[model samples]
Target: MGVEITSPNFKANAREALDDNSLQKALGLTVEKGFIKKRRLAADALPEFEALRDAARDIKNHTLDHLDLYIEAFEKKVVENGGHVHFAEDAAAARQIALDICRKAGARTVTKGKSMITEEVGLNDFLQENGIVPIETDLGEYIIQLRGEHPSHIIAPAIHVNKAQVEAEFRRVHTALPPDRDLREPESLLAEARGILRDRFLAADVGVTGANFCVAETGTTIIVTNEGNGDLTQTLPRVHVVFASIEKIVPTLEDASQILRVLARSATGQDMSVYTTFSTGPKRPEDPDGPEEFHVILLDNGRSALLGTPFQEMLRCIRCGACMNHCPVYQAIGGHAYGWVYPGPIGSVLTPAVIGIEQSMHLPSASTFCGRCEGVCPMRIPLPKLMRLWRDKAHDEKVVPTAQRFGLGLWVLLARRPKLYHLAMSVGMPLLAAFAGSRGRFRSLPFAGGWTRHRDLPAPQGRTFQQQWRARRFGR
Candidate 1:
């Protein structure tokens, strides 16, 4: 089945996810073992880390400004190096192009590296429907594939699943293995997956992977992974296909290197991912082992339109996922609640651009505006600012609900008149404080069920800040 878009009902999805015990357990581990501390250590170790972030952002900005020229240069170099570049305007076009390539190659099986672009385009289901098997090589991805679910996290696809869940899935799917086989630990699970995927890798006719960065100067595609699966996925097959979004392009190898310096530190807290592979084209005549055919499917999917607009800064995202990792909202609920390929803060901004704001208004509104995402972002993309821009657009288009608009309208009216605001706040604070009684909190409240449903609302102190300030200044 094609990956579903549930972004329109993100609130409902988030509510349901909040109630799932299994999901909650998995999400808790993410908080305990998050990238924040490690990222801090890595950044502290490199005094030039912040400078590299600025350079990375500048490189992306410069490349985007000259994207057309660089795309031409990239394509020219690809052809010169005996590789083909296919431009896809949207998801459908991308799917059809990939399917056509598979059909031409007469591929029966294809191995895939962890590519969110492929998930975005629903490539696996499309290929399966056309009678081709698409095997996921990434261990996290492979687990999710067995469960027939989309990835919950960008880098950790099966982050919502625990070891027991994986054990159950392996037992259920790998029935050919002995029933009494020991699968108690993660190492055993890893070994089982590796053995299974190794066969798929060698038997596959086509390998599809996502590019972390595509170099314009040399027409090279790069993938950075901790596991060696991506290398195996691309090299073992006869045809290698790279799925990449338009904004993935960098002007030169040096520009890619600048971004690479920060990518791993922000992502997994490592100085570098274990494997960083660069492929310029198909294997040469004398090359020992590489794909015979190399093709890149450059997907637009509404990214081109984001240029020159307020949302253009979103294109600077390197998909390190630090934003999601640091987001309090995402930490509590996890990625599936966002109901799309991309989730967390980046998803909130980029989803609306790709799928339309009218259908994804909830995503932008989902933020707490704590700015942790922007704080942790390697490219310094100002994610919270971009999310606020989406909110403004949603309000301008009048797509926001009537209740929200009315509430905002009331606030705006009161906020415009200082005397009226002060009077209302003075009265409201006293009333709210009295309602809270000696407990100093409310477990439930009328007209604010959403806030009270999960946590208590702290009571106001019965005195407005203005009153306290006046009393302190004049002893009134």
Candidate 2:
């Protein structure tokens, strides 16, 4: 239930992950395979994809600007539709509100859809500590839940886990099953998970899900999922609870449509997710099958504070996760190395904002500034720019490591004086180039072991860029 801050230890976590053979193998096979190709194909097929992305970004910007009005309108509509809306100021508040709802419903078991917000709030463990069992119905979530780990990826929670690992967990947990059952293939593993989760769905007293978009005009909480587990999770239980952050609200259903167009494509490379459910309220009297009670817990959790700041543009994120998908760093080390609920470039920028830069400074610095995340982002979020903002904040606050600070300080001192900078570069460049001789790359460097240990640092060819530029420009 407690929020564990491990962002400060990203270096150590990344190092351990790099050496983990199982994780590395899993990441290697999956990271570059599905999402990227599918997303590219999907976008290419859609002639208006770029226009839709622009519209989605503008819609989010406008809604965020008028967030207060939309929130009020949303609350009113939810009330009108026979549902309750609770505002939570922080993670603790959000967890308490959800727990109170479950308790009021006398919930002994809760079925959950794939919700990163629940993970953010540490809700599953909190509910369990309160004597309520929370079952993750999503296959990916189910796998990670059994292992007592958080989601490694946003869309694919168990992407870091291979079939062998899953088979082992299933055999270990589902002892009632035949020991000889074949679970080698993904299909068999999925079938086994489906059979096990079915009973939990029927037995659950409460259903919890996170909303992808909340429609203020219609009082609708929208969820897009490839699996139908979200539908079952929200409908089968007596009470349904929706978890969402403040930025999830859009002005109307039309705005939701604009965002939805890009959400699935940017995420899984599908034109549309299999299930897009909209729940306005609880089951009506004439309704056949749905939850009798509906409640939404809207958590601010420091998001409201970011409204007018330089980071406000981050609110435009639709959680499509294209940024992480295309990120070279994320692809190499995988999501767990980021050490937080969110991972990759989006995580790099947002984690520090929600959690504080002091605790998550390493996340921003983990990037190579490759700009792929920004290029692929559906909402056009300037991920690299935002990360730089975080880095600047870390430097201003003096939260960066002493060694890093000293290095930057030394560079700045030399940089301010052009003659000293040129002298150092002019002298340092050729010596380094000569030291390389035939190889032209350093296998190891004194202060840059971190870079050189894993891969060779390309040696300078000859003169520095400044030296070349002066010779070309003034004929020096």
Candidate 3:
């Protein structure tokens, strides 16, 4: 929610939002009601929901393991269909490639479908900075764009902005917009936005969209959305550019369908999204409509390195956003707390993978080790396990502060030998018990100063849990 998208002084911003009754009403309604509906719909639709999840996981893993072969085959198909394919190793290269294509096409106005890759590359701002106007065709994204805000949710970008907020944005941005024109209702707002953007769609020189799945067999870039915006974006303009991560390329349309089964049911509890558009290439002479020039930009952005590793399972994500729906932290703080385009469990893992874990070391630790995210994940992505691996990798890189490192080192020493562990606990317990005087909790922890500042910790009673378990089992 917008409550979580505070740019600076995030704590203060959140504090203010929590205190604001209007904002809290909107935020709480979004989380509680939306999640309940989705969960119920998912349960009622599929009796073998759990098994289907496992099947999707297996299919994704298999596709990822053979990514190179599939991507090569996909590129060949794209070339044969009169579409140009470009590979970008990182965001900078991707931005350059996309900007150059737009420049060659002389694109002044561009309409876009929802794309996390574009957000990752800051493509919208980049294009606007170069004097080209970019319009988000998706309704949610359009609202956020008009408000000069980033997406707060992947599936529902403007979820944070309620009807009242949207009415305000429309009144401010849409000049000469009549207060008497029924801006109060959501349907009225949608009508105004559609009417306003219809001309932009016809006049725009280029259409930009993200590929949900790229079929290697036919070079078709498949896009899925509830509305038909993706089709309009792919067809109404002279040139089309599809920005997709390399991991999105699958062996065939059949593989894409397997993913689709879980994708809709997980994200929005729908059996299928309203529109699933597939575009093979540019318009042929006989074809009445479609882009004249088609370009597919396959972005690696550190995804290739994740292959052959524990984190590779993450690539199996269909972006169904079920993990976000089930995440405790995400529900509390929302997507913007993670500070990237992708958010929730998937973002926490993928952001550090794309950027260095050193820069995003706090992300993995942001969770409470709650397994709900993994349990609800349609792909069964073992999010907590992968996050732990990232935690370990960040530690190996010395990303943690020196003081914390020293404390952990001491803990490791104490944990190695049973004699030292028991001896240290014996010495440490009395001191802790003494500090935990009246409250029965340590409010001012010495080593965990930052942690204790916000919350209290319980003092150890006597011995470790392992000791108690061993004593009960074998009378040790």
TM-score of each: 0.94, 0.95, 0.89
Worst 10 residues of 3 by lDDT: 1-10
TM-score ranking from best candidate downward? 2, 1, 3
Q: Write the per-residue lDDT of candidate 3 for residues 237-342, one digit (tens) a residue.
A: 9999999999888888887887788888888888888999998989999999999999999999899999998889899888877787777666666666566677
lDDT: the better of candidates 1 and 3: 1
| Clash list (residue pairs), candidate 3 | none
| lDDT value for model 3 | 0.82
Which regions of candidate 2 deviate over 4 angstroms?
428-441, 457-476
Most accurate candidate by TM-score:
2
Model 1 TM-score relative to the real fold: 0.94
Give the per-residue lDDT digits (tens) of candidate 2, residues 1-476: 45577888898899888888887887766668778898999999999999998999899999999999999999999999999999999899999999999999999999999999999999999999999999999999999999999998999999988889999999999988898899999999999999999999999999999999999998999999988999999999999999999999999999998889999999999888999999999999999999999999999988999999889999998888899889988887888888889999999988988889989998999888999998989999999999999999999999988998899899999989999999999989989899898898989988989899789999999899999999999998
Better of 1 and 2 by TM-score: 2
Q: Could you tell me the lDDT of residue 2 within candidate 3?
A: 11
RMSD of 3: 3.8
Q: Which stretches of candidate 3 lie over 4 Å from their true place?
A: 1-27, 427-476
Q: Between which residue pairs do clashes occur in model 1?
A: none
